[model samples]
Target chain A: MTLLDFARGPAMQFAIFIFVFGIVFRLVGVWAMRHKRDLSEPRQPSAWKGGIHGLIQHAWPYKPFRDKLMTDYVIGYVIHLGLLFVIFFYKPHILFFQDIFGFGWPALPNGVITAISIITIGALVIALVKRLTDPVRRLISNFDDYFTWFVTTLPFVTGLATAGNVWWHYETGLAIHLLSVWLLLIYFPFGKLMHAFWFGVSRYTTGSRFARRGGMA
Target chain B: MSDATTTDIPVDLESKRLTVTRPDIRFDKQGELGDDERVQKAMQHFAKDFGYIAANYMEACVHCGACAQACPFYEANPDPKLTPIWKLEPFKQAYKREAGPLSFFYKTLNLKSKVTIEQLEEWQELLYDTCTMCGRCTLVCPMSIDIATLVGMARHGMFHAGLVPHELYTVTEKAEREGSPLGATPKVFADRVEWMEDEHEVDMPLDADKADVLVLMSSIEIQKYPESMAATGKILNQMGKSWTFHTEGYEATNFGMLSGNTQWQKDMTMKIISTAEKIGAELVILPECGHAYQALRWQGANMLGRPLPFKVQHISEFLAEAVESGAIRVNKVDKSVAFHDPCQVSRRGGATPAPRKILEALGVELREPESTGNLNFCCGGGGGVITIHRADSLRYKIMGNKLEQLDATGAEMMVTSCSNCRQNFDDSGEKLHWDKQMNSLLELVAENLVEDTKS
Candidate 1:
């Protein structure tokens, strides 16, 4: 089979299977763990409200922390928004999603998606630079951190290269992009990328626990 | 803010520097256990602490290291190893190896190693000394990981391993054996109460056969700040509340909770629970202590394996309620004061507004720090760090951040409800040569209490 055909066929199917199976395995594993029931009377009646509050509260930096982490926070938001728009709003990506899910929404202009992708790539690069240079980040970062960064950034770079027709054959570039995408999907459920699913749990636990105690969430 | 003096308490600078000498910890059982046994016990305890919340926290950490910025130890010292998440390295290792969902993968792949005795020894400082478990890191984490809770869990393992700091362990052992970490036994507490009655001319009641309210005091207040006991009596008497100080459950401070001894924590909590139940107390009022409020108000029920029969309120919350309801009145103190929000009481316990409300009722100008209420910085002495003699320099360094925040408020005096926080401020202020007097919210109200005109 040609490289593009292999990328589009068996590799894609296997990647999809692993992604689904692994995520469910992880989610169920986490959910099935022992939960210590808080028997104490709650100061606030509604814990779910606190959970929702926490989900949103963590989206922005607390006031005192904002100025100190301004650059990092900005870069983080940029990278996330860029990945979001490029992955779901780009016409080809939406069409790809439509192929799998049997539905699609109006796609953003290709130019706009491309610009966002580029900006996201820039943010990812800055994030990488900060990770490598910042003392605390560098000390705490392990293989999972750097590897996830590479895994996340590769598809953006390869997709841009393929679409922009930048110094590569279209078939070859597309195959590389597809392969990178598959690699990300396979790794998503295992590595730090799994934060996508667990951040909510973390936030909800904190928000609810604190709110129940009448603490600021 | 105006610099009108709030109190005439003279600054006591002639005292020696804050003690950093390590107390000899009695380790009868721990001494008999081998290193491997300690490690095994630590691993077992860590596994026991494993639950859905801890599992999610471990999985959710993205290594963003934003928690470092929020940590006072890292902020003051700028040491990468002092980063809040880094403090949990060994705990995370234990979790991944023994309890995580992918534990099989981790063990088979050898992704995480078993925690060694040496690592535990090295981590004693990181877990017990440097960290205050102030929950600031938990607040600032982008992933919302409750790093503070994990730290507390890690302490359970550390305690089981007999790796707690000497001073903290000594205090915990004391609280376990003597019921008061500072030697404030039943007899001493009675004497102090009697003394306070004579000294302050307040109607101080001893253990009552049955009462609606049970007033608990920290050993620190009993030994160092006896005025707190008098202040509590004055207020209760003025309000005509049926309250009595029960020697059995008098200790509000729980060094066991501070030192991470869960069993001892339960024992300490149960003492209060049973005592309050014995008296048929409708409410138990915690003294000017932060951890005591947390131990009894929040963790008391969970430790008892059932909900506590009686309600618990911190002294600040009680004062706030009393003043708000006009159950008691206080003469207005015409002075500007900055209120130091205790980490456990305000930030962690959710009594952030209680002290403020009391201050407002007293007609004092409240000069709020930039980081006030639940967002306030810790006094660098919570979480049993105050007792760890080895942590003094680091604790003092961390106090710099709080000092700056408080100084910026430009309030003439500082008032706080937590006796532990007040002691830290007094000690640090003395050593740092900061002239601001650390006043007590309870004392402030007692001194300014308006007499009942009808009487």
Candidate 2:
């Protein structure tokens, strides 16, 4: 078989593995965290509604309700929004769907994906640089933070390289993607990234747990 | 802990040890804080969940120090170590160890990880003993980070560890054993109300099975601050509202707020719910304990495992509702006084029109503090911390910011809706030397009360 053919089959296999194993690894890590016994009485139906209102009190457009969040929340929002768009909307992701899963859809087109990638990359790089330079982040940051930023960016970068499929032939691109996907998965169950899933569940449970009971959250 | 600061961490205790010594209130049966084998396991659980929420949700914090400007303790002590978030680090470090990847390489990084026995000792002061879970810090975070929620979780961890404040645990023990936090037996609890009945024909009824309102008092009010009960008694009689204070479930102030022990909190809640249900109370009126108001008004339903068989209302709310309903009339006193906002009533309710309406109704001339309503300062107490003498130093330091605002008002009386605030205001005044009459709104209102029908 040609290099492209071999790369395609194995690459497809690894992509499916990453999708399945990566999530499992994340779930395992999250499940390991304790389920706080919501001694907070189970909420009532009306109270559950009140709880929704209570949690909403802290939400963005946070100006009148919470002024403390005024400063960098907008910045954080923009950065995250950009990253989300790029990560999920990239041309290669669309290509992966079409080629690997034979799904039909409108892709971001390569140029738009590339532009979005630059913005996301720029945001992250600035954040990392700021963490390194800022006294507060520097003080609070451990090796894990720096390592997390570096490790998290790998899938993005390798995906970029693999997207171009230009340098070091298709073989190099395929290998890098395979290795990065695996490493990311193995790291999932152990890293801070697992917060993605657990934070929401914990927050909703916490809100539900304490919504109408009495005191504060 | 300087020699001059009597309120500083005590010398009476050479070292801290975990003990749940009050045999009267056995909370072991209510130890339902999930799968933790020990308090440490609970501690670990608290840290992981709290830390992850802070990390991912709070990841974007710029640390611009805006929240520092908001914290009264930060402004008063200026210790930098006492900043709300700084106070959170001991718990945060534990979070890092259990849920952080840094745990994978803890020693290599000098993470200072682990909820060590020593660390738990510091948390006793940091989580419960000092910080009040007032929600001011949460309101100030740039990420809208709920530092207060973490405080709640950490407090639960502390409660699990049996590190509840001595006074509150004592109170809870009394409530559990003697049926009142003050160790007031049903007979004594009834006698206090009975004394009011004997004098001036004023009575706050006890266990009126068909009462419309069930009044729940913190045990402190029973023994030390019966004037509040009398004011409530006088007002209910004037308004002719169907109300009774429970002799058996007389205690509403839960130690869980102080200790973070969910079981005790739950049990306390059950007592209130069952009492309210027994009396067929349509409305449950919580006395002026700020946290207690939040506990029953907001949280009691869930802890009861269903909607409370009755509606829970704060005394302020009840009084406010009465005045609004035109059942009672207030002649705003011919006086200008500043209102000290209880953190729970102000922030939790998101409005203060009720008491303000009461003040205006009382004919009391009102002078607004520069910070009033939602922006009003914390009364330097809440979260059951004021009872911890060891936390007094930090507590009073935080009180300075509040005092400054009171002084700004130049109002003769600092009217508040909470007993905890009243107590803390008194505690702070002894040092700050402010002579402002720290009055409970209900007490003050009931004293000047005129019947709306008569008017």
**Candidate topping TM-score:** 1
Regions of candidate 1 where Cα sits further than 4 Å from its true position = A166-169, B1-30, B453-455
Alpha-carbon RMSD, candidate 2: 7.5
Residue pairs in steric clash, candidate 1? none
Proportion of native contacts kept per candidate: 0.81, 0.05
Q: For candidate 1, lDDT tens digit of each residue in B6-45?
A: 1111212232221223233222223446889889988988
lDDT of each: 0.85, 0.63
How does the DockQ of candidate 2 come out? 0.11
What is residue B209's positional error in candidate 2, in angstroms?
6.6
Candidate 2 lDDT over A1-217, as tens digits, reads 6545654566556655765776675455444544434333332445565445545553453343345444345545556676566666766666666776777566576777777666767767777786677554555556557666776677667777777776587776766665665566556544455545544444444344444443333
lDDT of 2 by residue, B1-455 (tens): 11122111221111111122332332222233332344465565476355334444333333434455566666566554556665666566665555544445554565555556556655566666556777666555534556766777776666555555555455555455556544456787788788867765676678777788888887667665778888888888787678888775777777655566677778878877888778788887888877787677666765776656766677887787788888887665777888887877666543356788788778776888766676666766677666555666766777776778777877777788877787777767787777665878888887788755551
CAPRI band for model 2: incorrect
Q: Second chain only: TM-score per model?
A: 0.94, 0.83
Give the per-residue lDDT digits (tens) of candidate 1, residues A112-153: 988998899989989999999999999999888989999999
Chain B in candidate 1 has what TM-score? 0.94
User: What's the CA error at residue B139 for candidate 2, in Å?
Assistant: 4.2
